[model samples]
Target: MPSSISVGREARKANRRLSPRAMFLREFFRRPVMVGSIIPSSNRTIRRVLDRVDWGNVRMFVEYGPGVGTFCQAVLDRLGPDGQYVAIDTNPDFVAYLRDTVRDPRFSVVQGSAEDVESIVADHGHESADYVLSGLPFSTLPPGVGDRIVAATRRVLRQDGAFLVYQFNPNVRNFLTPHFDHIDYEIEWWNVPPAQIWWAWKD
Candidate 1:
């Protein structure tokens, strides 16, 4: 049986009929740098990024800037029974919305910067993440923030874990190059504005 809190949340969600795209646009206008895009990531982009993951071995999957959870359900669908998905974002509205909407035992959303990913993962009872995905606009992040997030992500991932990233700006790869020995990437032209996708392995 569902708890009263969850039941209440569901009722509120039903009453709040705003679509995800509408909510995304509202947030983007408020914080374009943080939200990254006016619309949710294209389906082609999601598939291109997620399909690279070895879902069978993923125990903990961490995502940065999940903006309205465009990748949440897709990750959940492929996640193993015991796998956990932790999404970190600085946007309170997106965090609250995801908490209310994404009802799954394996899903957890945190309202915090990705720079604290190591401690965040620890607090959630995980030693290391098998994968960390980010769609953050590193090129526009406040000076030093992007570096901190990349360094922290490297430390939190297991040896063989991978960091998957998709961004409008390909310069984000420069952030990953120093930390990972091997990175494979390409452009997904099917997206509205097209997106640069990357899979950087910790090796």
Candidate 2:
């Protein structure tokens, strides 16, 4: 997703594809509960997440379920000098691999559930994040788990913070509706099976 790292339109477009060395599907198995993708079947949405965010105004950011760190690179590129990236995923294999794949000193990868972000960050000495982006598949979560994660996110996101979530299903609106001050969608016409982007900002 780091478009600048690989110049040229063709290369940039190609860069959007999953990394050849990436263990995307295998990593998904590490935490079936959080992986939105059925693996190879839904990998395209991961690339879409990288292509849709505002590069500026992003300092300290957190990413949930950053499988293969596709969006992680884009976020780090846009981050300010003191900017830091904290990525949390339920997949331990992914957390390990993603950590090793990134070369930035400012990036931190955590192998844990998204529901524990606040505690995880506290351990790392970060109070709350400027932006929190999530790729967790919320539509099918067990009843209270979805709400619990949202509440945890709200606690870790500053008042001016922005949180972005990408889902293949529109039902996500229900989980976010009562909690967020704003919820909007960005549609991707060509993504495999097509998809919707959900943007949530705190009041």
Candidate 3:
């Protein structure tokens, strides 16, 4: 049997794993626009988003602004081996961290803008996505950027696909309503700051 000293060393190694919340704070301080939230999303918020996914038929899923991958892991946990999960983030640090940490064959981490969803999906050899989850701070984005992202999301999603977005405020509804045919909204107050989830889809 291993000695107590060796067991203690193994325990310490496990505890050294990087905290996504700490990473979020560090990145937010460096680039508030890119990082968005001061802290990583809570499990409540993540569950709310994941619950909206139609896991049975969802072959391709895209995540916008997946900072430190709070939702990424949840999605991967439920995504099948044949399913494809692509995460796009403009922050290089978050991208690198995700690439190094998330080890799933169905996962791809791209360092790019959410506005490029169409081309990014094409580059990955996927025609369109079944679901697109956005963790971006649309309300805080510059004029027209949020609109462009919403438009791009609409363009890249399949006819039956869904666009799921969680925002600190309801301001993004204006941008989403014009692009999607139907919209459903729900509020989850268990998060660090209460969040509103919007599920939009075309007829």
Candidate 4:
């Protein structure tokens, strides 16, 4: 019936269904513009991005494009008992994976655009998020989508809240500049491709 290559492809697809890394690679190939890297973020990058948050005062923490729950457990671990962690992603596969694997009452995964963060937060019974994390590839997003996401992110954050972003491209800074008065960044060289971590405050 099938050729060797065809069988290999099918076998890999099956493996992807069972393996998180394989699934992430599949999604990256399926949507390179949406996924920043084929490899998941490193633990060092996760710590650098998350350390920017003031966990004690955080009531709600929102995330954009949380591929394969990389930061979910970390956020949940640091979050207060009463805090909420809501993650939004356009990738159905990622949203589904997070929903199926992350079994925390405080976490909510929505298959949607990051631009709708404001309404999404409202829908979840929160007025504003204390911190929002995103690793979406802003430099690759479709025209106008990046602008909308940054603008809406600013609107959905509390007064002292910050937007935490880790990206391979430093160009994401351009998208953040107009919305945030204060922005700082560092490079986490320990990551696969080395990531630029940013903190854009809503001051």
Candidate 5:
């Protein structure tokens, strides 16, 4: 029988071999409502999301529904050595793939729901996050689930921190308005189905 160490190594290798698009497709097919999109986010959408962040002041960041980590690499690249990143995804496959692919000490991958952002962020030894990014499909989620996630996001972010969300529809803006002091919206048509980006901040 293979040793546990050998089994673990094989799992990691398998995860590494899975492409983001393939993983997205598999997960989407398995759970359309949970996976949200049929394909991984495009480079254009990733840029629009990351570009809105004030990287200079960001030290701790959290990502809700990281999926296959399309934005993970870019965020890691832009982070300083001391910067910390944590990603939460309810999909077990995505969580496993992220753990194997994003090999960075500063990164933490959690297999949990986005509504638990506060406790999850605390598990990583953070009191509050500088930025919280989400690729979650708010329009597809149940009203209660979406509200809880949005409320948790506001509670866990520092006063000066920002929340960046990208969705296929503009409905997310309505959900964010009550929690944030200010909100800004932009559209990226270069993406597959196009995307709407929202940058929200509190005083």
Candidate 6:
């Protein structure tokens, strides 16, 4: 008989050792709310969660770890003319792809560090955003890096809005807890290996 294992577990393993291409596609799927790392092989579940949010009154949506622009496209499609989307990616390729591929006036693609999301958000003329979604790898970043990203998210997200993050590693929950009023998480058992999506919301 074959062993039956969860996809999340597989992703967790793959995450510990990701191929370059797998690393690339993982961005096709997720954004984390707390940390600042990208696992291109683990994003489908992240997208699934974002699709469930009620985006009606959301005028501005900011995405960290835009990666290859998977989440960026989703944000642009949902955010109407009245809605604006800004994506921050340190990868020049992803940032350039985002800028060239997505031409909507409501979309802005930036190449920058996830830790500086606050200034990025403010530079875009947003003091507080309706939503700040992230895909940064929180588990592997330096200690204060994850906290900084979360802090920036909190600084920008509106009182009634959300700060969503995805993590393959459960190691950073401590930092994630103090920054948000509510935190929600899920295990994606069907992805390449699988991953966890943690939504940190403050309202």
lDDT of 6 by residue, 167-194 (tens): 5667657767888768887878766456
RMSD of each: 4.3, 9.0, 7.0, 5.0, 2.2, 11.3
Question: Each model's TM-score?
Answer: 0.92, 0.78, 0.89, 0.91, 0.92, 0.76
Clashes of 6: 23
Per-residue alpha-carbon lDDT of model 2 for 8-118, expressed as tens digits?
A: 544434434547234775555655666766543244564565554555655568888777776765677667777788888776556656655688988998887888989
Model 5 RMSD to the real structure?
2.2
What root-mean-square deviation over C-alphas does model 1 reach?
A: 4.3
lDDT, model 3:
0.86
Against the hidden true structure, what lDDT does model 5 obtain? 0.87
Ranked by lDDT, the better of candidates 3 and 4 is 4
lDDT of 1 by residue, 1-203 (tens): 99988986775575356688888888889999787877888888998999988999998999999888899999999999999999999986788788888999999999999999999999989999999999999999999999889999989999988899998997998899888888998999989779999998888
User: Lowest-lDDT window of 10 residues in candidate 3?
Assistant: 9-18
lDDT of candidate 1? 0.89
Q: What lDDT, from 0 to 1, does candidate 6 have? A: 0.69
C-alpha positional error of residue 109 in candidate 3 after TM-score superposition, expressed in Å: 0.6
Quote the lDDT for 111 in model 1. 91
- Which runs of model 2 end up more than 4 angstroms from their true locations? 1-22, 28-33, 39-56
Clashing residue pairs in candidate 3 are none
* Cα lDDT of model 3 by residue, 1-203, tens digit: 99988976564344336687777788899988766778877898889877967898888999999888889878988988789999999876777778778888999999989999999999988899999999888878889999999999998999878899988878888999889879989999998788888999866
Off by over 4 Å in 3: 1-17
Better of 3 and 6 by TM-score: 3
Candidate 3 is scored at a TM of 0.89
